[model samples]
Target: MFQFLRKVLMIELAGLNRFLLGQDLDLNIINSEVSRCNNNILADLTNDVLSVKSKFADYINIKLGKKKQGEKT
Candidate 1:
C-alpha cells in the first residue's frame, strides 16, 4: 500500500515538474521543495499507521485477556 502511494506520488510530481518547467520555473528549486513535501507527507503517513497499529494491538490484547506492558490488571 505504501509502495503504491509512493509510486503515485512520483508520477504526480513528475507531471508537476514538467508543467513548471514549461512555465520556465527553476527546476532545482521546484525539485527541492517537492522532495521536502514528499518526505513530510510520507513521514506523517507512517506515524499515522504506527499509531493505528498500536491501537489495534491493544485491542487484540484486551480481547485475548492479555495485559499490555505496564497496564493495570
Candidate 2:
C-alpha cells in the first residue's frame, strides 16, 4: 500500500504546487521514490532530501547568473 500512497501523494502534491519551487520539491519527492531503498523508510526519506539538494540552488543561480536563491522563481 506504500506504493499506492506514494503515487497519490505525488499526484496531490503536483497539483497543489502553486509556486514552481513547490513543484520542484514535488519532483524531488518523485526522484526519491525512483530508488527502492530496500523498503527502508529512513533510506527513502534520505533519498528524497538528497534529491532536493541535487536540484542545487547554486546551479540554478549560475544558470540565471543573477537571481538569488530565495527570489521566488
Candidate 3:
C-alpha cells in the first residue's frame, strides 16, 4: 500500500516537473528546484515510515508484556 502510494506520488511529481519545464523557466533552474522537491518528498516519506514503525514496535512490546503478566497469574 505504501509502495503504491509512493509510486503514485512520484509519478505526480514527475508530471509537475515536466509541466514546470514546459513553461518559460530556465531548464537548469527548474531542474534544480525539481530535484530539491523530490529529495524533500523522499525525506518526508522516510520519516513517516520510521515514525509508524516505532509506534508499532512500542505497541507490540506493550501487548506482549500484558500477555506475560496474565500468564504469570
Candidate 4:
C-alpha cells in the first residue's frame, strides 16, 4: 500500500512538473493527493512530497521573477 501510494504521488508530481515547466501552475491534483497521503498516516511520504512541491513552487517563482515577501534578494 505504501509503495502504491508512493507511486501515485510520483505520477502526480510528474504531472505537476510538466505543468510547472509549461507555466500552468495548477496544483489541485498534487495538493489533493498529498492531503490524502497525510490522512492515510503517511507522514514521512507526505513531508517529502510537500518538500518537492515547495521546490517546484520556488522554481516557478524564480522563473517568473517573483520574490516571496520578506525574502532577501
The residue pairs in collision within model 3 are none
Report every candidate's CA lDDT: 0.74, 0.57, 0.88, 0.67
> Which one is best on TM-score?
3
lDDT of 3 by residue, 1-73 (tens): 6888689888979898888888998889998989998888888888988898899999999999999999999
TM-score of 4: 0.36
Model 2: per-residue Cα lDDT over 1-73, one tens digit each: 4576577656755554434434545676655654333246446655876776677866786877656544765
Could you arrange the candidates by TM-score from highest to lowest? Answer: 3, 1, 4, 2
**Candidate achieving higher TM-score, 3 or 4:** 3
lDDT of 4 by residue, 13-70 (tens): 6665565556544578656654665465556777877887799999998866655544
Per-residue lDDT of model 1, residues 1-73, tens digit only: 5677668767876776676567755778877877786687668777877887899999998876655544765
Q: What is the overall TM-score of model 2 with all chains considered together? A: 0.29
Tell me each candidate's TM-score: 0.60, 0.29, 0.79, 0.36
Best candidate, lDDT-wise? 3
> How high is the lDDT of residue 62 in model 2?
83
For model 4, the stretches where C-alpha displacement exceeds 4 angstroms are 1-41, 66-73
Model 1 spans > 4 angstroms off: 1-24, 66-73
Report the CA-based lDDT of candidate 1 relative to the real structure: 0.74
Predicted structure 3, TM vs. truth: 0.79
